[model samples]
Target: MKNIKLYQVFLALLGLIAILLTISLFIPEEGIRVFGMNLKFPTIGRLMHPKKQETAEIDNIIVDVDTTFADPLLQHQNGSNGDMGAPNAGELSVKNSTIIHLNDAGLVNLHNFFEKLSSAATAKKKVHILHYGDSQIEGDRMTGFIRERLQNQFGGNGPGLVPANNVYNTFAFVQTYSPNFKRYTCFGGDKLNSRKYGVMGSAARFTREYKDSAEIANETSIKTGWIELAASGSAFGRSRSFSTVKMYYNSCIKPCAINVYENGALIHQDSLKADGKSHIFKLTFPGTPGKLKFEFSTAISPTISNFTLEGDYGVQMSNIGMRGSSGTIFGSMDRGVVAEAMNDLGVELIIMQYGGNSVPFFKDSASVRNYASYFKGQLNSLKSMRPSAAIVVIGPSDMSRMVDGIYETYPFLPYCVEQMKKVSMEAGAGYWDLYGAMGGKNSMPAWVNKGLAGNDYIHFSNGGARVAAQLFYDALIAEYVKWSGKGE
Candidate 1:
């Protein structure tokens, strides 16, 4: 009886739909009025065919962002170089996205930093800007674009700082090494016991770690290690043209003679000081040397802090990509060594990209606030190390995780962003809302579907990174314009 009733009810619904279709077909375009308002019905032709609703594209979904920044492509075409190319970093038109919040002191610091950039060439000192981030920036994805644009526009050259035995295979520069080289990092599982990881927060060694002077004196044979370097085939023009090479090391007990060879023949030779303090050795080539090889002969290897390729003046921006960090490790490092390294490099700006690594462990709003507070402490520590440097903290980009069988934005992420910005402002640092700029909550799904982000929905693709970086660049240029009273 129940089955019969369900079938009858289904038939009645079908009959009702048919009746409505026939009535709609018979009804005129101006239907019979039932009240003061006129009624309308679909015509036979209209009833037969219906229009479809179109889905909006990625740009269409971007809401509440200031889209006034000149289209990067079109802006590049207006370059004064006569030939069509992109303008320099500071040459963009109109304000970009709005900064979440920055206190008055932070604005003053930014202005001071801009002064440094503008007068760096006149002063004959290069402004070193350290971009610290997680794996998203590893291998020079987003930072590469920023570096290229800044170097071309501002006065920087060379890929900022390439590790001696690079762990990440970055295309901006190429380096190959002998098998004996070992690496240790403060951020990794195989960290140094001394906790003396310098400004780069990592070190590379060609031989065993130095323990005592006796070990170096009793050495039987000189340890030989080598690294061959060549600019990659697709390297950016600015990154490839470097005239200076600076080697940083510390805790040396044995004098190491380093030979710089071009192809088969040695072009230069220098010896490392057997001192127990940090030191930087600089060598300037007559021109951009070709296919250089650095051969080391040392009985006791010092910690190889960093190897930097740079020009004579302007800016030097280094990407310090730590794989899994919450932006809270600065206080744990040897403060004197880090400060000396920054001073040596003339660091004036520190752009810290973090909060992504901390988002996964955020169980609630309190956790988010706590992490932000902890991050503020690290920022304070960094400021102490580089007292004159201005800091900018870029909050995490949109990240999604599988939640209840559907990929969705992680909960408390906005809270995390809120707390981060609050603390950064309190710490007198500028904060960029990467999450908001990329589109807010659940935007990762759209970015992933549009090929702007990877399948993991946590990282941006190369194309997306370019967009992200451009947004940031525009923000900086816009504020800089406001500060300088130019670029109207």
Candidate 2:
């Protein structure tokens, strides 16, 4: 009697399993309607046996291509460089939807930039390309590749325009600072009490905080804060060369002495002003130095605005990265100081790539449009500062959100991309669709599957970043090909 009862229970369970398998075969692949409620049906194999979740392994796919030689494509010509071929970045290239040129003028501003680029090697001054972005480029990911390619195509060297106190460990250059240097930013930090943050939207100070004279007296002994930079051997060839270094600072109310060392030998020394005004200290080397160090000794530390490393001539692509910025904090900075920096650097092109930070919080298309509207004002303000400079806006790449236990593209990413393109053209700036180039809807998952993106589904892994940068470079060159009448 017990054996008979057990056999009956086993038969019942097998019957139920057979029924589920039959139902799954007829249901839509996406899901099925059950009891008037949309439900996803599992595959027979999935129902029978579950697959384990696996994380993508971070691979060293980036080859660090030598960017020291000029690209044959960048050679100047009247038009028709034979068959204008598409750009190749080793593995991937831009296809189908190239960079969007919204207006009839298209990339006229950028075309003018190309004129300077063609003659960059012989230009009287170095032409700068300021690539401002958020954490996507915080460690100089996409921007570093873009810089490498451009410098290779044009004639340039060194990583341009680095923050004095970098929060991210960037491969472009290795920077280390003394602990006394306190970081402050215009975007988000404890109130700085001064709105003098420069174009980069941040500054660092070595002075100790004071509550009264007692605090100052207690720390009267002169303390020193130093920042040292050396060419990172892991970086690409061009990024490893630095012949010119410029330091921007302000708010020095006390005499501060600056000593610069090249390869551990004291090369230059100078004293800073006691007046509270913006100042620039330039140190140029006749040849590339293996390492460079700046040591400052003072009773009070001056606000160190920023630092720049560059070649004497050619295109200098500066990665002006802010960790959590949405490309909307430029207006909060000192306009005069920003203008000064722009002019002093001889900036001719500005590439503003953002929107990732705002993706998750965006409510709807209207919200995205509103954000773009505010962003338009910032672009206009930048134009006012550098009237001749061309601005290009790079839309955010595809970010994913977990839906029904699967990572899928955020619903409104395309809407945000369109809105940004519309406003960018309205502001007389060029636009690039990073999302579209990355394989439109539901593409982040594929990138992750290929080990090109991170497991977080938000940031691109090193391999993914290199691919995106290459696509962007290819798109830019394609537009230039058309603008220059090189391709029919």
Candidate 3:
């Protein structure tokens, strides 16, 4: 009797397992939601979905992105220009049609800003360009190259902005900080209760809140926040030196002492005001310095927003690269802080490169459209803060996903790029097709094969970043050349 009952129980367990396997086979591969709640079924769905490719060979796949893909706007041109004498301000290139696509409305409005950048060196003025992007630019990959090239062409020095408590070990500049500093960003992790993340969508502090002066004095805690910046030996000569260093900080309740050291020698010591308003501390070196360090000693840690190292004149391109951001957090940051930073830096142009982070999560057409609309709002917010700053939106680059053990371009990447271009144009911003520049569909696999991209088929390697940056710089120069002719 006991043996018979044991056999029945074993059979029941097997039956339950079989039922679960059957349910897994029917679950959505892309995931599903009922009444706005995610079904959390991807783990189960993977048991059956994305059927593994049998005898798949990556080399067998032939990818010719340039031949098959062209920007949608190319068709709309309709041979509008009767005579293509010299490429006009917003004319499509007759050779490749990869030049910056200027919305007629935006070009007319931003004509002066472009002219200002073109004349920055001659005018002996500091023109700032904020290149904001997602993980594609993490560690200043694309932006650093662009900065090096532009500074070599125009006139500038030093890596523009270095964030406090940097998550990515950047090659643009060598930065070391104490481990006590906590990183707070608008997008992820343990965010601050105040939500006062700066323009970079992040800030770092030694403590989360204000501490009583007596308590701080009595406290023997060794927790302190400090950062050091020196020229990375590998960086270009132009970016390896700086004439000025400006630190941006806020949210200090008690006066805190800040120490500045130059080449390990104490240069200056000062105390910050207890006032909670944004503040800028400027230190001008006698000439381009090789190294500088900042040590903050306070019981209550103030939010150290960012630091800018720049030259006396020429174009200053700040690489405000935020990892894993969708470029949508600008709306949530403190507008006052953003406005102050924009005006102080005199940002004349804003180049936003995003959408690669949004590729995998897009479920359908509605998702793409919604993302476009959402991104447009962020652009509008930036415009409102810096009305004089001309905006250029670089659409998503080609990204890949493995399906059936074969890596191919995401099915809707091209669609997402087109929608982004439309909304950017509608929002009175110029659009650049990074996707097309990279050779379009399935180009990531090609880039990976060439060692220009990572094995993940997402982010670019250093060489790939240089290539992308050059393409963008070339497109930008093409427009500037036409604008420069007018000045001549």
Candidate that would win on TM-score = 1
* Residue-level lDDT tens digits of model 2 in 1-488: 44668878999999998998898767775786779988887776665665544332222222332223344433222322221112212322223235656575546788888788767665435789999988888788888888878776666777888788888778888888888788888777743555667778888888743436566545556779999888787776677766778899877766789998877999889998767788899876655666778999988778888898876667788887788889898777888888888899889999999999998989888899899999999999999989989999999988988854767678888899889999999998999998877777777777788877898988889878888787778778777666656665
lDDT at 52 for candidate 2? Answer: 44
lDDT of 3 by residue, 241-340 (tens): 6667898998876567889988899999998775877999888765655567888876678898888887766667877777788889887788889899
TM-score of model 2 vs. true structure: 0.80
TM-score of 1: 0.81
TM-score of each: 0.81, 0.80, 0.79
Off by over 4 Å in 1: 1-57, 60-90, 212-217
Off by over 4 Å in 2: 1-97, 208-221
Per-model clash counts, in order, read 1, 0, 0
TM-score of 3: 0.79
Worst 10 residues of 1 by lDDT: 76-85
Answer with 2 or 3, whichever has the higher TM-score: 2
Give the Å error, residue 277, model 1. 1.4
lDDT of the candidates, in the order given: 0.77, 0.77, 0.76
